[model samples]
Structures are given as C-alpha cells and as structure tokens.
Target: MTKFISICALVTSILLLTSGRPVKTYSELYRPQFHFSPEKNWMNDPDGLVYYEGEYHLFYQYNPKGNEWGYMHWGHAVSTDLVHWKNLPIAIYPDNNSTDKVKCTAWSGSAIVDKNNVTGLQEGSYKTLLAFYTSRGCGQRLAYSNDKGRTWKKYAGNPIIPEAPGEETRDPKVFWYKPGNHWVMVLYRMPGGDKAKEGISIYSSTDLAHWTFESHITGYYECPDLFTLPLDGDSAKMKWALLGGDGSYMLGDFDGKHFTPESGKKVLDYGQNFYAAQTWSNAPDGKRIQIAWMRESKYPGMPFTGQMSFPTELSLKSTPDGPRIFRTPVSEISSLYGKKMDKTDKNIIPGLKNYNLLKGIHNECVRITGVFDVKSSNMFGITVRKSRKEAGTEISYDVKKQLLTCIGSQMPLAPVNNKIKLDILVDRASIEIFANNGEKVITDNFTPAEQADDMELWTHGGELMVDSLEVHEIKSIWRE
Candidate 1:
C-alpha cells in the first residue's frame, strides 16, 4: 500500500525528465552502488522473487509515469549472480477495463516454477514460471511466462480467486507442499474493512487455477509470507515461519491446511526502513535468500525514489530465547569486493581522538568488518561516511544498556562472549549493519556531506581490544 509521499519526490521530479526506460550507466548521486534500484521512478516491495534456469527474476512494485506512487506496474530485472542485474520490460500492468470502483493495480505477490506442469501451461523445454499477484480491489490473479521471464501472458481465467465480499485481500505467497501434494497460498486480508481484523488467510489448491479457503489467523498485516526452515542447521528439525510486511515474524508448525503457532512474534530487522521482505521461490541448493524494500528513504534530485536492500541469506538458529531468524548478505556479494585493508590486535584508547584507522582509504562504497573485544570500554564504535567537517554516522554499542545504536535507531543487542562482531556494508546512500554474526541487523539510509568518506574506530571511558578489522572497498555494479 502507498503509505505517504516523500518531500523529496517533488524535488526529484523537477530535477530531470525520465525517458521511461532503464539506463545502463548509474551516475546519479545517491544511487546505490550494489543495491538493486530501478533506473528511474518510484519502486517498492520486491515481488515475484524466484530463481529458474540460472537466472533470478526480481519483480517489484513500480510507478511508471512519475517519481511518485500511482499507475502501479511490475518492473522486471534478472541477474545470474544476484549482484549484477539486467533490467527488463515491465512484467505486468493494471487492467484498464476493470469494473472495480478502486484502481486495479498489480500489487505484491510471489512466483513459482511449475516444474511438474501442474497448470499445463508449459510451452517450452523449461518449466513454466507462474506468478500470482493481487489485482488490487478486484482479487488474486495469475500470469505465466514461457520464455524465462523475457515475456509474460496473463492467464485466460484471470482473477482465479474472486474478490472477497466486504473485504480486500492481496499479496498471495504461494508454495508447493510436498507432504500434502498440493499448493498453499498465504494471503493478507482486511476483513470487514477493519484494521483490527487484519490477518493472513490460508487457501489450498490442487490445480494452479482454482483455490479453496482453508483457514484464517488474526495478527499479521500486509505481505504475508509463509515458508519452512530447518532450525540450527538440522534438516530434521524444521519449523514454519510466517513473516509479516513490517519484518515481524512468528515461528510455527504448518500441516499444509493450517498453521499452529509455536513462538510469539519476533522482529527480523530492527531498522526504520526495512519492509515487505520476500524470499526466492524455487531457489537452488535449498537456500532461502530474501530481499526487502527500504521504505521511507528520500532520494532528492534523482529519478528514482526507492531502493531494495542488499539480498540476504536467511537461516533459523536456536537462541537463548527461542528459535530466531538470522540474515546475512549472500556469498555472491564477494564478486564486488576490491581494495582490501586489514588490521589485528590493535588497541583503541580513549585518548585516541582525531585518529583515523582509515586515513588513506576513502571510498563511498566499502565494507567494514570489525571484531572488538569489549575489554574495559563502556562505549566503543565506528564512525563511517565521515569527512574533515562532518562526523558521519556512529554505530556504537552501550555496555550497560546492551543496546546497539546507529543513526538514531537502536537495537537491543548483547555481545556474544564479550566480543562484538560487526559486518557493515556502506553504500552511497545506505548502511546495513549485521551485528553479533547476524543475530541483529539494521538498515539505515543517509545522504553524506560533500567529500564525506572517512572512517575511524573509537573508544570511550577506557581501552578496547580490536581482535581483527578488515575494510574492503566495493566495486559499483553499474560501472563495468
């Protein structure tokens, strides 16, 4: 759903006129170096994420006409390594002759590979790529791509699931259930026009064309995703995760028709911007990789208004509290690593003011990995995107409060074994911090001052031991 327009949207539109096409050279200021963003206009919510035939397809909510939200269409892109992307034509669009009073935009949904020819829609040697999406006020719809997502055709029997009476339903996340030998669709619903009645509705289908209502559970809102993950890397100990649009999730058990809650709600990212995350369907090697919309970020004087977070691999690990989800950037990101620097066994003292560990190295796009032993320091952190004048953003941990703070957002994170490990990815406009080995994640956006590219490590009140620190400058995917 379109929440609110950014104040920067007005300025972005006045800066330049869009060509209504994807541009290869991403030279615009604040453009992400490695993140996936459309060349122009408004984009949000990663939809129809699926991997097939060595290509990963990324479809997102796009506004084609301007740098603001409206005229929703499914913008398409494909990547072999998930780091470099080639933009494609718009996959789906809103129906013009819709009879619904409200606009019929192609909203959020999921895609799957019909390897078994379940729908009998395959026309080539490769399996059919089936995408299920909501036609806004109308209902759930289906479209099929026979040419590996190069082209798409809407199903003849559109709106496979009719609109609900006195309600609105959207964002259908469909997956195959092996044990039950059928398909399960988890959809977000607003029953009786009541926000309090907002939750996820379950449906089952024997064939891809028709669906039957199975059950409804209250609590979740918008972009409901249901998938199974093995806990603690144990394939036999599997659990179902029901993720909501706001990055909150619940661990449970699913029997294809119904879901039984085993754990309460837990956050996936304690950041202000992360939202509407979706996993790749039919991913190879049993990997559950995810991408999310970095909502509410403003990109002034640029053609694009929103960007997607760096793709991450998800895993379920047993924690002291319970089984929680962990997210780390995928291994494929190493393809963009360049110009590395390393340091070990360095001491950070309180008197080391104006000291820069990254004195000679200054780059807008880089990765910082630091493992600091909280020896006797009450506060220790790193400052990135810094300049001689601007102090940049501080990513620090408070020992007494057990809180990790960055850019005014704080995550309650405790150090593991008295050592705080941080893997930070800094781009032109964003910073993604993965702390304590992905136990906590924060995604933040910022516009640095002119020439703000310095970095440093600091300690407060006492001394800190830096076990190891490594900085790797990232090569921009847009450039060669």
Candidate 2:
C-alpha cells in the first residue's frame, strides 16, 4: 500500500509540471515601472476609492481567469502613501451560484466609510465600510466590511434598486451630501430610443439601503461623478463639477437634489487611453485626488494587460475660458525621482538632428519638464522611445495651429505668454503629458522595440529656445 501511494504521488507531480502555467516575475517587457498594475491577468476602471484609517483603498474591475475581459471581480489594493501599493485578495466575486445562473458580474462602483454607523451594521470597534456596486444585468447592490476592508460580504437584501424598466443602468457613484445631511448616488442609465432621457439619475439615501429618486441630469453618460470644488481655491466660492465616463465635464451648482450648469461642456483629458476616472471619496485635507484606467493598451507576450494612470490632484482654476479644472501629479511622485539632469538657455536650430541638448540621455522611465520659448519656430517638440531603427513617438507643437500633438492624438493648446511648458512622464509602455501647468493634457500608450529608450529635441522652420529643461529618472515602485 505504501509503494502504491508513492507511485500515485509521483504521477500527480509529473502531471502538474507538464501543465502550461508559468510563474510571473513582474519584470516582463513593457510592464509599467511606477504605475499601478495587477500582478497578473486583467484590470480596468478604478472603483471603490476611499480613504479610511490612514489607508487608501483602491478596488477595480478585474478578470481573474485570463488577460481578456470576462468573469468580472472586484480586485483590491491598499496604499499608505499613494505611491506604493499592496495587492490583496479579491474583494467581491460574481454570483455564479445563484439558482437562476444569471452570472451576475460585479461591476464599477464606489466605497465609503460609514463612520456614523448609519447602516447599524457595525459589529466591532471599526465602523462599517459600505461598498455600493452594480451587479450587471441585476441592478445595484450593497456590500459591507467591518474589519477595515480586509473582507467583505454582500448584503442579503441585494439588487437594492432592481433593474429599471427597459434600460440598462450601472456604475453607481455614491457620496455624502452634507447640505441635506444625506447620501447621494449618481447612476448611469442607458437611453432607450429617446436619447434625451439617456443620462445620470440622482437619488438620495438616508441609510445606504433605501433610495429615493431625486432628479436626472441629461446629456451625461456612464460613470458619472459629481463633486464640489472651490473656484480658484476660494472656500467662499464653491461650484459643482460633473464628469462623464469619457472625461468630459461641466461646472455647475448642486442644490442637494439637482445640478445647475454654469459652463459649457469641456474635455477633461484629450487622451485616447484614459477612461473611467474616479476620485477618492475622503481624501486628506479636503483634496480631490483622482486615478484612471489606461484603457486599450496592448501588453503582448506578458502576463498582465492593463494599468492605472498616476494619481493627480484636481483643482479648479480661473482661466481665460471660464472655470476650468486642472490636474497636477501628486507631490508623492517625487519619491520615485532619481538620477537628475538639467539644461537651460539652449538653442535648437531648425532641421537639427541628434542635438547635443539630449546627449547621453537614454532611459525608459523618467519625468521630463521643459519650458520652451516659442521664438520663431513653426514647430518644436520632443521625441521619446527612439532608437536608430525606429522613429518612436513624437510630442510636437504646431506654432501656427496652436495645437499640441502626441502620438496620433491632438489637443488645442495656446501658448501662455508666448511660452509652453510640458511635464512629461514616460514609462515602458505609456506617456502622460501635462502641458502648461496641466491646462491641457495628453496620454497615450505604445510598445517600444528593444533598446528603444533614447530621447531627442527637435525644431522645424526656424529656431527655438529652451528656457529650462530637467529630467529625472524614476525608480520602480515594485523594487521595495
């Protein structure tokens, strides 16, 4: 009997060795250096972002089986400083065991700390943390955590708001409305024939369970977010901003139940790859910090598929074009800076190639800031991820057109005081550009060939002046 047991164990070990699953190293080619990405499989749409107990929790839409989009789950991670992240177990999973076998997948939503015990579910010293998410095809649901988000349980009274009549609704963004001393939920409801009615439906809740329909804001689509920001940093003057799934926004006023628009619609980001941005519910010091999923980025021959953009602080500033929102990278990003380089007052003549301004600078992960004197050039810009065998990607400015172009996408950016400032963060597979103090931004993704990690500055039609330039190589957050 002992010999037979040993033979069976050997057979099982050999079968496992022959299986085709390989261990992940987190150092695969094109893996993000500083951005947040899953250890394996797929991730998208940052969900359930809230701050509690000195920890920032980030829950996201995830697929656990493969690097493609199916079998949705709520993946979890936490960070103390927002620069370093630790992945936790799956927070919520699909309800596949139901008798109907509807395969209800957990979709995007928000999380908040029930500090006041409004739900009356607090079982221990820790206040209940409520997670409101959509059970795709089944309507919205509620989940609760009492042990500081380490574990969660779906409420027995799920499908809190059952499927609406003839409309597909999802992505619930819930927040506390202090003016009315209640909670507000902004939900996305798809249009059914009458496009005018296809918008966000606002509802108020007093106990995080029972909801009362309030009003609907038309013309806004999925993943709606409504927040109040002080115009120009003046607490006395506050305005509400409503954002859509595609990063388009409008400034308005929210009077508890309804939002009144005060400005025309505006694009928050002119990036093809940025989508479903969500801000933290309880950020410190009343600051609005946001993160987005860099969508549609291809990571060929790797174990992971998606990444989140670097966290940015959102502020409302008075611009020539009414009250516009500006996004600047959080101060914690400096924690990754290393190996600095600087240059100033450099002349870049037209038709120049391999200019000495960028000599000996070759890195895939770095933060670059440059203030350029437009001078007389018809075009001036920077090229990155370049090598002898590739033209790489170009981030150029067209002087006459007053436009900034990155990769294949473009945004109209007027020069501020006849000068343009660009803050560029380049990783192995993505580029995020903040032009003119975040007045206009562009983000894109591309897979660079091996050894394609050099940079160059070029001009066309005339001379341009580099008032100042600084480059800092960024260290990987996974290096510990």
Candidate 3:
C-alpha cells in the first residue's frame, strides 16, 4: 500500500512539476567518504530523522520513479548499526486530493519519539511518530504516525506555525530543552544582512505553541542542528553546540531563553563536502554521535553520491586559544583486519608527498601515523589512487588550513590541504576516510571512472614522510 501510494503520488507529480527539472537516480551519482545513496533511486536533504526503539530511522526527500527533487515524499530506511540499512515503505506522499487541499511536499523537518506520550500521543498510536516539517508552497506542518512510522497523518491544525519569516525559511529541528523551560526550535534560514549572508534561526515556545522569535546564533546557508552536551570531564558542565552549513558553533550556558558563545566559532569537520549533519539521540553510551551528508562539491542538482565518514564521537578539547571541537571515528572500524598486515617503519621529511611503497597488496588497508612537522607547507596534502587524473580515486589532506578533500569522477568538493596520516576506507564503489582518526574526515560515494585499485601516495611539491604504515582489510558496513 505504501509503495503504491508513493508511485501514484510521483506519477501524478510528473504532470504537475513546473517544467525544466532534471531527473536522477543512484546509477547517475557517486560520492565517497560516507555512503548513503539510495541503492536504486534518488535521495537528498535528510529530513524527519528519528532513532526509534532500537533502530535508526532516516527519512529524506525522495522521488520514487526518477532522480529529481520534485514530487517530494518522505522516503525512509532503518539501520541497527549505522551501516547495513533496510529500506522501509515510503513514509509520506502527497494526498492527491484537491490541488488546494494541503499541498504537501515533505520539505526538510525532523522527528522525535514522544516517549511520555504527552499531548495524548500514545506509544501505540500512529501519532507517536510526531514530526515537524515544511511543505514548500505551504507553511509548516505537524504530522504523526502511530504504527512505528509505517504510516503518517498530518496534524488537523496543519501549518501549525502559520508562516515563516521569509520564503527560504525551512529545515526545522525541534528539541525539548529546559533553558526556556519548554521546547525550542532551531531553524535553518537566511536572515537579511548588509554586506553579509546569515544562515540559522532560533525560535522559542513555552509549550510548542505561540512561538517567539529569538536570536540568530550566527548565519549559515544550510540545515542547522542544535543540541546540548555535557562538558568533556565534568558531566555537570554542559554546553550547547549548533551544527550547520559553514560548519558548527558551540555556545556556553544556554538558559533555554538564550545562550552566549563562550569560545570561538568552530568548524567541526574540515572536509569539502560535509553538511546537513544529524546526531544520534540517546547515544548508546550516553555521548553524542554525529553523522553528515558527505556531498560532492558541486551545486544543486542530483549527482552521483559518496561514502560517509564513520559515525564520529563529537567532543570538545580546551586549547589555550579556546575550546576546540574534536571528532574521532567510531572504534568498530578495526574489525576489517584479516591476515594482510604489512608493517613498515619508514622515516622521511614532514612535507614530502610521494613515498615509494611500490609493492602494494590487495584486499588490504593501510594505517599511517606521523607527528606532522607542521612546516610552511602546512597546506600538507596526501593522495591515494592517483593513476593519473581522469582515472583512479584520489584523496588529499591539507594540514595548513585543516581539511580532508577527495577528488574522483563524480566527487566534487572545494579543495583542502594540510598534514596527517590518511585513513582510507576503500571497498568497491565506497570510500570512507578519517584523518586524525575521525576528528577530520572525508567520505566519497563514487565508482571510479576506471578501477586502479592499487594504492599509491603522491603530493604536489616538497617532501612528506610516513611515521609508520600498517595495512588491514576494510570491513564493509554492509556485510553482516
């Protein structure tokens, strides 16, 4: 029934879309580093995200029959572990009723598990899958699903928020916070600025009703996610961080009513294409785990996709300069090792790009550790699969400005340079990489124009060396 509805909705949309839209599919796009492209279709701007029961429910804008952005429906999937995902029935589709009756587009919004069933939202009630999202041509809408998210129903008092400040105002993330003594909403939108563009809006509500405009934490051009975390060592020392378009920001002492940034604004991951980030709710160990859409560096249009950095443990490190946001790959990547373990103790200058390890092995992984001499080439970069441009997979690590960038057919991100060991996760069309072991990472989901699977390292100029290099098999999150 869900599939039929989704198909019917899309078929009807083809007739309604305002011409000039391009259709795309998984076969047409590629990205490496962090992987989440639909196995056979189109997906973008993850929305209404929820970690329910024991499964991670991820919903995004999808077009069932084509690779275009219109005819939006809430496409969904569930994962026990972040990898290995199972496609669920489509979550939401256009009503196909009257043209004027609730023009639903399922724009960007988020979900929450009403554990207490407040608002008379019963656990077994379909309404339990409470969601807050935008419908594009329409205003903001509230929706619910009683049957564990298999189905949905828009709030009777739909367009619950009436109107947004402007036309581009969307991507709503709601959370239950005590600072203002009630639930607050953080929306990603541009604010009018002179000589500047801002992204991200903050709103407050005493009981999910009567919203009050607050402050603009800062401006960004993409989805903004705000959440509170306990200080590094003292559980009592809590801080709130905002994750979005240009990167992320950490604010000190959130009073629910407002928050002031204690330290400087921080860029969480220096990768070229990391954005539209989401976090795990009620983390398994109680700490926050974050994941992002590792995209190609090109502008909007459905293109091939890439892999994702493994789930990163987001933390804060206090530096004399200020509090530095820290990230590290989840510890489970170690399971990829088998018999192929190559150990080499090679020492060279900290700025050299080409290290001769001509004899490479297959079905293997490499781990390099170096203290980075941090010289002028701080734009220190590392590359893998440089079988001469128009071919193999290539990744670069820029130490100077702190960024992890990858380039390949279909991989498009702003360039990055710098230093450090490159943890390249390569398997088939997937490539997941974590530099600083996860603090900074890049994932590309692309099928190399041609497979030069043999791994080699190179750089533009100067010399950089390997402190230590170890090899192991890369475990596929898809393999059970």
TM-score of each: 0.93, 0.93, 0.75
Evaluated at residue 118, the lDDT of candidate 3 is 61
Q: Candidate 3's residue-wise lDDT over 1-480, tens digit each?
A: 999999999988987784665543332323321245565445667777677767777777766766544666777877776655677888876542423323556777788876666646565544376788877656667778888777787667666665544546667888887544677788765554322545666788654535777877555666777877665656776677877754566567666656676766666655455667777654566667776655552323335322334566677655445555666665655554454544455544443454544335443233333333333343444344435444455565455444546653122122223336555566445456655544445544444544444565444444554445665655544444
Off by over 4 Å in 1: 1-25, 97-102, 353-355
lDDT by residue (1-480, candidate 2, tens digit) is: 999999999999998987766634667788898899999898999999999999999999998888988778899999998989999999988764532223588989999999899988899999888999988788899999989999999888888888766777889999999989999999988656366788898999998899998998788778889998998899999989999998899898898799889988999999899999999998999999999999997988878889999999999999987888999889999999989999999888875665548768989898999999899999988899889899978889999999999878999999989999999999988999998899888878888887888888888888899999999999998886
lDDT of 2 at 2: 100
lDDT score for residue 354 of model 1: 45
lDDT of candidate 3?
0.59
- Residue pairs clashing in model 2 are none
Summed backbone clashes in each candidate are 0, 0, 61
Q: Sorted on lDDT, highest at the top, how do the candidates line up?
A: 1, 2, 3
For residue 29, model 1's alpha carbon misses the true position, in angstroms, by: 1.3
Weakest ten-residue segment in model 2 by summed lDDT: 94-103
Error of 2 at 123 (Å): 1.8
* Ranking 1 against 3 by TM-score, winner: 1
